[model samples]
Target chain A: MTTEFATRHLRRIRLVLWGVVTAVLLATGGALMMRSYLLPPTSEGISVEVATIGETDIRSEFTLMDHTGRAVTEADFTGRWQLVFFGFTHCPDICPTTLAYMASVLDLLGPDAERVVPLFITVDPARDTVPVMAEYVAAFHPRLVGLTGTEAQVAEAARNFRIWYERMDDENAPDGHMMAHAGHMYLMRPDGRFDDVFQEQDQSPQKMAGQVLARIQESQDVK
Target chain B: MRVLIVAALAVMLPLAAHAEVVVTDPWARASILASRPGAAYVTAESDEDDRLIGASTPIADRVMIHAIETDANGIGRMVHRKTLDLPAGEAVDFAPGGMHLMLMGLSEKLVEGTTFPLTLHFEAAGEVTVNVPVLGVAASRLDEGSK
Candidate 1:
């Protein structure tokens, strides 16, 4: 009888131990899941997935003529985000390629593209006249606006954007000479602030469209 | 079956050996207006050492090889080149913001989606004609859809 009673006591203890072990395991698992799902991400031990370009300040002042011969400034682009690229119509490679990429990006954005302006500002203002700008932009997206101005106006606009351009007077050049300009595509916020710059290799329609949409959402969140 | 296979291989080998330098993905940006200069790009690879001496296209009055470079001050500039070196087993990609063919005095405006003929002259390959497809003005690389 005493042995039987001792055996029953041992079994009870074993059951309690198992119950405690199970409870502890469940608590630990719950804590880990909570830490993963509920807690904010810690920066020190984590690798950032997407790296973005640092934002910079851009000059918001300048008056230039749009493709339609209309005078335009930052005010003209206000209330809508602007995707600006600096190139001329004569630019056979970089300009057209970048514009096409931007066109695809805008197309992907669909209805969201209505809130954005794609601007093609000619660094070769001497040759990119109003009519030329109009015709050139027409070949790309319908929403693309080609901007040009007099030499001084173009210089001022380029200076404001911190972009560079120069005339090449090579005698052996088939075009007699050509204009060489910076090939960066700038994403300007609705407030005309410099948001990001898209380099050649990192540029894709889908990637840029996502970045633009994210930036817009970020700005809205800030407000 | 062995003899048939060997005969086919022999016939193919001679044709491939004669055409050492191959030009592919030839394309040009559409010109907004006729008589304006345009640029063309191509991927040229060689099984033997060769040099891209020049290029010709009837679409334009004259074609010249050019290289666009960035100066120390960060300003971009175009340099005229008479020839471009193409080493054996190496692929030379003529891309934007780099080496390209300048098509000057365009006889007609190159419209997007249209294809034109361009002839590339190589020191070893002699002359290789390619169909240069016209793409959008701001297109950088030839995507599958564009090709």
Candidate 2:
């Protein structure tokens, strides 16, 4: 009788231990999943996830004046891949750096670059006139096209692309004001659909060119 | 002998203060246009805690210390800083995306492959002048061959 009682006690303890262990494991796994979901996307972690593409409703519809003072729209850039960047020429550091990167990416694309149209849309339309943009884009790549428009047109374009920009007055600034704007580069498909968005931290020209070429090839294969 | 010792102390005092801080890798991005501001970067190391009070260059009318702060969405805003603190035994880097010297009202466009003198003023180190090399507009760091 005592032997049977001890065996039953041992079995009860073993069952309780197993339940505790399983509960601990489940809690730990749940905590890890929650942490990942709550954490903000880091530069290194988020750029690799191609699945996140198109999750945001980004469009390429805009009516603006080209650097040559020609009126144009999204339809004007149809049948060609567009790399769109929104910035002001007055910006000294980030805008120029990103434009230089875009120029390098184009150089890396070489002949295939002809299929791509790199657009620089100004956020500060008040200061970035057609001639200013013409001179600014000329300093970067020969093929780079600069675009500027009226405040309402620029605002509509920025809203379509989900770009945020604000002008802050500064006494020391050249124009007595400075603009803060998003720095992401948008790669639009030939069909005017958003293909990918390059973050400011992605400064690799070679990698960008490779990705662009791969996408182009993929689209061609589909056709 | 006493007169010689006094003269030696006077010369050595300034030298000692200057030797406490070392500035290197001074460089600036070539300005794409004369109407726009230019940016310059340098690495500074100090033996004792010091503050970078001001900076100046003959090429620009004003040299303002600025820092680029990025929000969670990766939007960058340029903030003007009156001074920068350099802690003891720590190297403060003024790089492309972080802290930089904003050269405002430039006399002329900063052409590539050129050099200019940048004078930095420190609370303890006094005024130190570094010959800054102008790199390409998109250059993030000094090239391997160029100093």
Question: How closely does chain A match the true chain A in each prediction, as TM-score?
Answer: 0.70, 0.71
lDDT of 1 at B131: 96
- As a whole number from 0 to 100, the lDDT of residue A21 in candidate 2 is 97
Identify the CAPRI category of the predicted complex in candidate 1: acceptable
Compose the digit string of candidate 2's lDDT tens values, residues B1-147.
Answer: 999999999989876676467999998889877777888989999998899999999988898887765558544556677789999989999876567788877898998899999999998888889999899876866762164
After superposition, candidate 1 runs with Cα above 4 Å error: A1-56, A170-182, B1-19, B68-78, B112-114, B135-140
lDDT of 1 by residue, B71-114 (tens): 67555556567898999889999887677888877888888899
Best by lDDT: 2
Give one digit per residue, the lDDT tens place, for model 1 in A124-217.
6767889989987888889999999886887787777777554443333233335454367788888878888885557567887888899888
Regions more than 4 Å wrong, model 2: A1-55, A172-182, B1-19, B72-75, B144-147
Provide TM-scores for the models. Answer: 0.73, 0.76
DockQ values, each candidate? 0.25, 0.24
True lDDT of residue B125, candidate 2? 84
Please tell me the TM-score of chain B in candidate 1 relative to the true structure's chain B: 0.80
